[model samples]
Target: MTLSVHWRLDPAAEPRRSEPGAWQRLPALARDRRVSTQNRFDYFLQVAQAAAQTAFDGLFVRHRIEADESRIIAAIIARAVPHIHVVPEFPASVGSAVYAAKQATTFQRAAHDRLGWAIAPDAEPAGREAQADFVSDGDLAQRLDEFLTVARGVHRERPFSFKGSYFEVENGGFDAPLNRASFPRVYLQGSGDAALALSGRHADMHLFAPASTEALAKDIARLNALADGRSVAAGLIQPLLVRDERQTAERDARDRPLAPGTLVASYDEAAEILAGFAAIGITELVLEATPTLEEAYRIGQHLLPRLRALTSAARQAA
Candidate 1:
C-alpha cells in the first residue's frame, strides 16, 4: 500500500545563523534581522523541495500568507513544488476574494498542471443574518459553479474577466492556455450540505476535519451520492507529535510537550481514524508533523511504518 505524505515546512527548523570557518568557538554571527525575504523563501523552498524529492507519491502544502504578501509567497511556492496547492485562508469571505485572485495568478498561469485550490463552501443569506454563514445544499452547488468559472477564467486570460457576486477578476486571465491540467484540482472542507454539494461537482478531494468514525462514514456516503461517476477522493489531517528515540533530552526538548494536547494520543487515535476512513472509502491521509524537526523525522521513520502495517492488515481482513 502506497501512502502519500504531505510534508509541511516548519519555521523553527530554519537555521539561525551561518556557521563560518568550521567549529570555531566563536562562529560568525550573522544578524538574524539581516536575512532577506528571498533568503528565507529559498531556505524554506529547499526544505519543502528536499522532502518532496523523497519517496512520497504526492505532496500537499499548507501555506499561510497575508493578503498583500500573497504574490511573493505564491512565487516561492511555484518554484518549490512541481504541482502546488494554495489553500486560501478559511472563513473565506468577500474580503479574501482579491487576495485569492492574485495568488491564483502565480500558479494558474505558470503551474496549472501542478496546481489546485481548496475552497470552502460559501455561506448563505439566511445564515448571514445570524452570523452563522451555514452554507445550504443549494448554496454550495451554485458557489461551486462560480468558483470554478472564476478559476478557469483567471488561468486562461491575463486580464481578469470573471464577474460574480462574491468576486470579480479584472484584467486577470492567463495569457497562455493552462498546460496539461485544464482546471486546477480543487479540495473542499466541511460536512454541511453546501460543502458536500460543492465536493460532488467541483472538488477532486475532500479534507475531513477532526471527526468521529461514524460521522466520517456518514459524510463519505453523502459525498459519494453527489459524486456519481466522477472520481472523488477524501483525506484526513490530524496534528501529531512523534518521537521514536524518546530519550530524556529529546523528550523534554520536543515542542508538543506530550503531557497535554492530542499529540501523544494521536498515534492510536489516528490509527483508529485512518481505519475508519479507509473502511468508508477515504483514500489519503496527511499527518501533521510535530513542531520539532527531530520529532518529525522520528514519525517519518517510525510511526509511518506502523500506520502502513495497520492499513495493510485492515485491507487484507476486509
Candidate 2:
C-alpha cells in the first residue's frame, strides 16, 4: 500500500492559541479582516503552494459553519496549485445530487481529475435542520447513500434514473464533456457501524478520528469486514507537534496543550509512530498543525521524509 499525506486547510485564520503568548495578546481587528476577499484567496493559494512544495499528495479544505465556504476555496486553490488533489468537505444535503455532480464534473475537468469530496456528517439538530429537514440518523444515512448514488450515476452514464426516499431522478444524466470527466474520490468520516456500512458501499477512503493504535487497528478490521472485499482505504485525521529532540517536544506539549491524541514527539519517534500506523493499514493521513504556514514546511522538512523512509524500509522488509 502507498501512504499519502494531506494537509488540512482552514479557510479562515485559525486561532493561534498554540503559539507562545498567543492567548495573552489582544485581538487585532484590522489583521482579522485580511482574510476577507482577495487576501483570503491569497492565503489559501499560499497554503496550497506550500503543501505542494512539501510533496503532500493533497489539500483537505475543512468545512464548518463559521468558516468560509469550502468548495469555493478548494476550487480557487485547485486552479492555482494543479499538482495536488484539492478536497472540499460539505454536507450532502446542501444541493441536488445531480446539480452537485454537474459542479463536480466541471471541477474535475478544470483540475485534471484532482478533485476529492469529503462528505461532512450531519451537524447538531438546529444546524442539521438549517441544511435540510430534520431526520433520524437512519434516514440521514439513507439520504446520503441516495445522494452519492445519483451523483455517481449521472457522472458515469447518460439517462441515469433513480428513485429514493430523499431524491428522485427521471432520465437524468450528463452529456459530452461533463460525462467524460472522472468522478471525484469520495471520503467519509466516522467509526460507527452505520458510517462503516455507508462507506463500504461508496467511499474510496474512510477517515477516522485519532485513536489509540490498538483501537485504530480494531476499527480498520471492522471496516474491512464491513467492506466485504471492496477496496476501501483506511486513514486517520491527526495533528502533529514534532521537534528535533524529545525534551523540546515535551516542552512544546506542555506549553501548547494540544488536543488529546496529537502526536508530540521527536522526529524519529514521530516517524516510528506514523510508520506503525501504516503497518496496521493506514495508507492515508490528514495532518494539521497550528499556524499552518510555518508548520507545513516544518513537518515537510523534518517529519515527512523520515516517515517515508521508515515506511519504505518496512515495505522492503515485507
Candidate 3:
C-alpha cells in the first residue's frame, strides 16, 4: 500500500437536490475539514483496517487531540501500519479567524491527552507529557519561540528553549521519545497568508479543494516559495464528480447538476482533470462522493475499478 487516501470528515448537512417535502437540496458545507467528522468514529477502526488490507497505505486522523488520545490513535493505527497523522484543526470558517489563535493559546492546557502543559501521567512508550506545542498570535518571534520550545520536548536530542512574545521555555525534554525517531508528517488545509506560512514552516503536507490544473500549479508554486526549499510535500483531494467511462465523467460534469463544478463528466475528463493536479505537484487526490452514501459507494465499487484499469494501461503504455 503505497498510495494514501484520507477522508476529510467535515460533518455538515449540505442542501439536498430537491424540495422540503421530497428531498431537500444540499449546499456546500465542510464542518471541520478535519478527519474527526461524525460517522467516522464508528467506522474509523474498521476503515483503517480496510485501507490497510486493501491498496491504501496509511491513515490520518484529524482534530486537535490530547497527547494521550494522539498516542492511542497512533498505537491503534500502528498495529496495522505505522503512518498516522494527527491534525489539530482546520479553520473552515472565515468568521472565526481567531479560533486558531485561541486554540493555540490553550493548547498546552487542553487535557492529559491534549497538546498542553500536562499529559497523561502514564502513557505507553512512557514520558508522553513533553510533546505539547504552544500556539499564539501577534508576534513571529513569539510563535517561533513556542515552536522551538515544543519541538525540543518532542525532539529532545538537541534540547530547545526560547523567550519571545508568544512563548518562553528552557531545557525542555520529552518524557518518552517518539516511537519513530522523527515525527510523522503533519497536514494542514487552508488558503490564508498566515495559514500558508505556518504550513510552509512546519507542516509536512498540505491539502486543497478542487481547482483548474493551471490554477493549482500556481498555488503549489506559491506554497513552495514559502517553503524556502524545505522538504515538505503537497496533496490535492478533488471531488470526484464523474465516472471512469468518458461518457460518465462528461455526462456527470455537465448534467448531474448536484454541486456546480462538482462532477468532471467522464473518466478521460477525470484523468485530464487529475493530470492538471499532478502537474501542479499534487501527490495524492481523494475523489470525493457525490451527494449521498449511495453515490459514494457507486464510485468506490464501479468508477474506481475502471479508473484503476485505465490508469494501469496508461502507465504501461508510457
Candidate 4:
C-alpha cells in the first residue's frame, strides 16, 4: 500500500511553554491584537506551500477554538496550494448535515476533489452551548451517524429523504452540477467502539491517537472487522522529532516531551521505525512538529524519502 504523509497545520502560534493550561489563560482579544489577519493567512499559505513542495500528500488543518475557523482556513489553503489535499477538522454538531454537505460539494469542485472531512466529536461543552448544539454524550454517535447518512445521501442522490432520531429531511438533495461534484473523503477519529463502528460505516479513513505499534495493529484489526468487507484505511496522528544524529535526537526528546506516541530519533532510525508501522498496515500518517514550516522541509527532505524507499522495497518483496 502507498503511504500518504500529511503535515498538521495548527493556526495558533507555537506556545512559549509546554506546560498544561499555559496558553489557555490569554483572552482572545489579547491574542488577536498581536497578529493581523493578513499575516496569519500568509503564515498558513507559506506552510501549505512548503508542505506541497516537500512531497507531502496533504495538510491536516487542526481545529482550535482560539484560532481561525478550520473550514475557512482549509478552503483558503486549498485554493492557495492546489496540488495537495487539505483536510479540515470540524465538529459534526456545528451545523446541519445538508448545509455542511453543500459546502463540501462546492469545496470539492473548486479544489478538484482535494478536500477531506475530518469529523470530530463534540468535546467542549461551552462551545457546543454557544453553537446551540444540544447533543448529549449518549447521543453523540447516533447524531454523527445520522449526520453522515444524510450528508452522503443528499450529495450522491437526488430526492433523498431521511428521518432519524436526531435529523429529519424529506426529499432533500442537490441538482445537476452540485450533485455531479465528488464527495469529500470522510475521516473519523477515535479509539472507542462507537467511533470505530461509525467510521466502519462511513469513513474512508479511520484516525487513531498515537499508540504503540502493537496497540495500533490490534485497533486496525478491530476496525477492519467492524468494516465487515468495506475498505477503510488506517491512520495515525503522532508528533515526530528527528535529528541528523542519535545524540541530538535523544537530547531533543529529553528537552521537549511533545506528546505521547512521539517518535524521536535520527533520520535513519525514524525511517526504520515508521517503515515498521507501514508494514503493519498504517497507510496514512499525520505527523506534527514544532515550527511546522521548517519541519515540513526537514521531514520531506530527509525522513520521508527514506521511509518511502523502505515502504517501496517492502511492497516489491511482498
Task: Give the range where candidate 4 is weakest over 10 consecutive residues by summed lDDT.
Answer: 15-24
Best-first order by lDDT: 2, 4, 1, 3
State the local distance difference test value for candidate 2. Answer: 0.87
lDDT, candidates in the order shown? 0.55, 0.87, 0.45, 0.87
lDDT of 1 by residue, 1-318 (tens): 344455544343333422222222434584334323344455555544544444333344443322223334445666656653433223343344445545555456675545556554444566443654555644545555676667656655567676776557668754443323355566777777767776777678888776666887888888888786777887665556544433533464454343222344444554555565677676766555544334445555656666667778887886
RMSD of each: 7.1, 4.2, 11.8, 5.4
lDDT computed for candidate 1: 0.55
lDDT of 3 by residue, 157-236 (tens): 43545454544446543333231233324555567556567667766676766667777777787788888778656777
- Angstrom error of the Cα, residue 74, model 3: value is 6.7
Q: What is the C-alpha lDDT profile of model 2 across 265-284, one tens digit per residue?
A: 89999999989999999999
- Give the TM-score of each candidate: 0.63, 0.90, 0.56, 0.90
Shift in Å, residue 216, candidate 2: 1.7
The Cα RMSD in angstroms, rounded to one decimal, for candidate 3 relative to the true structure is 11.8
In model 4, which runs have C-alpha deviations exceeding 4 angstroms?
15-37, 124-127
